[model samples]
Target chain A: MTAKISIRGVTKDFSVRDHDEPFTALHDIHLDVRTGEFLTLVGPSGCGKSTLLDLLAGLTAPTHGEILLDGVPIEGPGLDRGIVFQQYALFPWRTALANVEFGLEAKDTKKRERRERARHFLDLVGLSGFAERYPHELSGGMRQRVAIARSLAFDPDVLLMDEPFAALDAQTRETLQEELLRIWEKTQKTVVFITHGIDEAVYLGQRVAVMTSRPGRIKHVLDVEFEAREGDLRADARFGDYRHVVWTLLRDEVAAARQEAPVG
Target chain B: MHLLKGLRRVAAITLLAVVWEVLPRTGVVDRTFLPPLSEVLTALANLAATGELLDHTQASLGRSLAGFGLAIALAIPLGLLIGWYRPLADFLNPLLELFRNTATLALLPVFVLLLGLGETSKIAIILYAAAWPILLNTIAGVRGVDPLLIKSARSLGLPAHRLFQKVILPASVPTIFTGIRLAGAYSMLVLVAAEMVGAKAGLGYLINYAQFNFRVHDMYAGIITISVLGLLFNVLLASLERRFSTWRATS
Candidate 1:
């Protein structure tokens, strides 16, 4: 199968005040996300995972190397890639439906069609009754659901999530993760989810990419498999084994990340 | 429960009115300078009968509205630009800071000398005083927009202009409204001060004229009318703010 996204020799550098040389956030990196694949990237704090997602979202550009989508070099932010951030980031002035209609408005869809599609996505996220509620009115989980519906509303082919559920409570996180998987199955879009949770990485990703910290680089990519994912998957022995593998890979990097002097 | 809350709010005002009526009538305070509330109400009724009250109110309202409207028209757009563009803000920052600190009232003589003691000077003073709060607040509002909201809009391929309209403009509204409400109160204050110093027909002039003529009742009446009008204007602005930003939690 052809890759939906290709990252080759991607590196990012930040210019710090009073520093003789620019700080490298990500060292030379290579990765491929297959079409319709759920790829989770797990790394220590400050390992440049968010920076990588920003690159994918085209919110920022790489200092060296290129990222391609279906063989075209990603230049800047576009409609084809939808992003979900850790904070809900819902426009407080807009109702849930209006927030979901934001991207559709950019697409210049007709009023009727925009309303219809916005409603459909809200229903998909189980927030059909909350179309008129503002972001401040919704609970945290509901707000994130609205955010998810918003990102998916315009029919983007790729979803780039940067710790979308990281701020949520554990129960909400699990519920959203399951909902996200359900949505992914229905939409068949390529997804790259960034997270610090090893269990989350194992449970959600078809393949989990573990990265080293302090000039982050991919250290390992492990394929995750289980007999069934419907229920009790987290309780499964195989789930624990996969979780252990990811933890073992991340252990040294996480410790090293803590001990290293923070890069300017 | 709602009716009880409403009655509670009214109780303080009623008590104040009762005290005002009783204080001078009971000889607790000098009656010449401080008339009973009933006497002031009678003076207000007499002014209304002569149509002088309406004329003075209209004059004050017209000048205040003109100056306030002009300030809003000029300030909001200019503020948005300065807030959005760093180069312009940088170039103008020193000038803005200089003028912002200069007291509007202190420049009253300059306005009177430059424009002469006509309606122009009073309106000009009102505009100058009102513009600062609105303009500064607007600039602050634009700058204070959540960065994440901007990122979210851009990620959806919103062009520059649309991003401004959709995200930046709406998000800055609450803060901008705060500035506008402040401007509303300032416009009334500066207009009254300017009219007191000069002008033939406004409520301020009426009150000042009454005091000189020793029509203490009329002066008190003018004061009460202007106070009530100012309160009503504030209520209208607050309602407008609520209308624009209904999404905000009422608290």
Candidate 2:
């Protein structure tokens, strides 16, 4: 399979102050995301996993190196790459249907068509009866589901998620993870997920890319060979081995990240 | 139940009016200094019958609404721009502060000199007084939008316009509405003061004319009318706020 997203020698830097020294957020990052694959970037806080996702989504340009989507240089944010955030960012004034329709507004779709399409996606996300309810009226998980439906409504090639379940309760997160998997399987869209949760990474990703702290760089890339369906996999002997290996690789990096004072 | 509650309020007001009507007639106070409540009501009826009350009310309402609308139109977009762009805010903040501090009523003479002592000058004074609250509240509202929400919108590949429309506008609605309500109150207050400066009509003019003519009953009538108008405007805005915030309340 061809790589859907290719990041080669990507480096990102931030200037702290007018007179202060510049800091590197990502250092010489190189990664490839295969088409229709679920890839997770996992690391300690400040390891620049979210930064890497931002770059991949073309929300920010890389200071050095290029990110190509299907071998085309990313000029700016486009509908081809959809993003879901940790906090549900649904528009408070808009109902679920309107929120989903927002992504399609740039298209030349008619108002009736947009509403119909939005309704379809809302139904897909189990919000069929709540198209008229505003974001403020929904629960946290419901809001996130609306966000996901909104992104998917655009039919984007890749979905970039930044700790999309971090703010949710354990039960809600697990339910969402299963829902995400079902959606991903049905859509067959490539996914680049960033998270700090090891189990989440292991459970969802075809490959888990672990990173080291400040001036973040990739430490290891492990291919997950677990069953796609969520049953007895946690109890699998190989699952424990994979977990142990990832934990050992991340141990020192977590400590270093904890010790380092964060700078904007 | 709501109708019953409203009836109770009307009953209480009527009781107070009855007490006022009885106190002066029963010699509890000097009748020369204080007219009975019935006399004030009689004066109100006379003014209404002659169409003077309606005319004055319409003039006052026109000035207040015009100034209030102009202030909202000017403040919302300017405030949003300043709030969204830090450099612009830094440059404009000091100037805005100076303008806000320059005692709007003090500008009455200058406004009259520039626009002439007509309706324009009066309305301009009201606008000047009303603009600051809306502008400041808008700035506060825009700045107060959660950064996380902004980040989320950016990540979702929202274009600049959509980002503002979707996230910034909705998040800032409560604050913007608060600014608008404050501006509404200011407009009413300043319009009265403006009319008092030199006007031939409006409730303010009527009050001033009554005081000069020593028609104390009409003066009190004008004062009561102004108070009622202010209360009515406040109630309308409060209902609007409730309508907008209903979704927030349910969740």
Candidate 3:
């Protein structure tokens, strides 16, 4: 498969304020995301999952090695990649449609085209009737939908999401996960979704990458294969098997993460 | 519901007006010193008829508007720059703190001496008083914009100028307007005090002149006019703020 995003021995480090030694966030991380693939990255908190996503989004440069998009080395944030954060991060001053149009505006899209494309993306996210509503006016679930729409409106080649549904209630989270899958199917954009939820990783990703804690690295990558993805799939025995596999892989890493940073 | 809220808002003022009318008439208060509300209204009407009310009102508004306008034009941009650039803020913060702490009214003698007891001194005082709130608020608004919003905008490949213009500027508006609204009230307060010291034509001068001649009704009328003008300006500013920041859940 042609690589949509190729992570090559990528490592990241942060200098500590008081300490002489620099803290390693990610170490020798290597993964190849296939074009038009739904890849979920799962790891415990402090495992540098978000830092990896930030690296892919070109928000922060890697301390060593490099990341590539198609055949080109990633330099910095560009309109070619769209990112959705866990927090809705919708501009409160802008309406739902206007918020979606933000990236398009940056691209210098014509005013009428921006409006139409914004409305279309808003509709795709099932917020067709709420184009005029501000972020504060919308419910948490709806606001996240607007955030997704905003990221997708600019027609980016890759959609990088950083636990975009984690803040939502259980019911909203599940519903959005399903909707995101549907949107990914329609858009055919290479999606790198980060989540801590085992079920979420299993349900969304065609390939799930598990990471180890403290100087994070890819521990394992398991392919999720299911006959049907509708309704009773979560109740199927195969679903339990996949969830079990992911949990067993994550359990030790989660424990190590807890020891690395004990709660006060 | 709306009508009830409107009536409730006016209830205290209505009760006070009734007390003013009855206290002097019933001899509970000295009539010469504290005239009835009707006498004050009558005096206001006489002032209107002779065009004295219009002249005084125009003069007060002109000075207040000039100083307020200049403050907004200068302070908002200065605030934005100071707020966004850390080095500039650090460089000027102590100087700002010093001047902001000094009372506008306390410098009345200095203003009179430096600018002379003319419109320049009065307007300058109003400008000095109004600028601080706007400048401080603009800085705060800029500094207080959610970092997440900036990150999101940056991920979209927005240039620095566009990021500041689109994300930072709009996000800071509600706070900046908060400053402007405060400055509006400050301008009114400083304008009255400045006018009382020197102005030949404002509502403050009119009140001072009336009090000296023992025209108590005229003095009360001037006080009432100032209150009414202040209330109207407050309403205008609130509506303007609402217009700019429509996304905020109305409190």
Please report the candidate that would top DockQ against the real structure.
1
Could you tell me the TM-score of candidate 1?
0.96
Candidate 1's DockQ: 0.67
Which window of 10 residues has the lowest lDDT sum in candidate 3 chain A?
A255-264
On TM-score, the leading prediction is 1
State TM-scores per candidate.
0.96, 0.91, 0.95
User: Which residue ranges in model 1 land beyond 4 Å of their true spot?
Assistant: A261-264, B1-9, B26-28
DockQ of each: 0.67, 0.48, 0.62
For candidate 1, lDDT tens digit of each residue in A112-190? Answer: 9999999999999999999998888898899999999999999999999999998999999999999999999999989
lDDT of 2 by residue, A1-264 (tens): 999999999999987777587789999999999999999888999988888988987878999999999999887878888888887777676789988997787554689989989999898889999999888878899999999998898789999999999999999998899889889999999999999988888888889999999888998999989654667576888788878888888899999998989754
Model 1 TM-score (B-chain only): 0.95
Ranking by lDDT: 1, 3, 2
Q: Which CAPRI tier for candidate 2?
A: acceptable
Instruction: Label model 1 with its docking quality class.
Output: medium
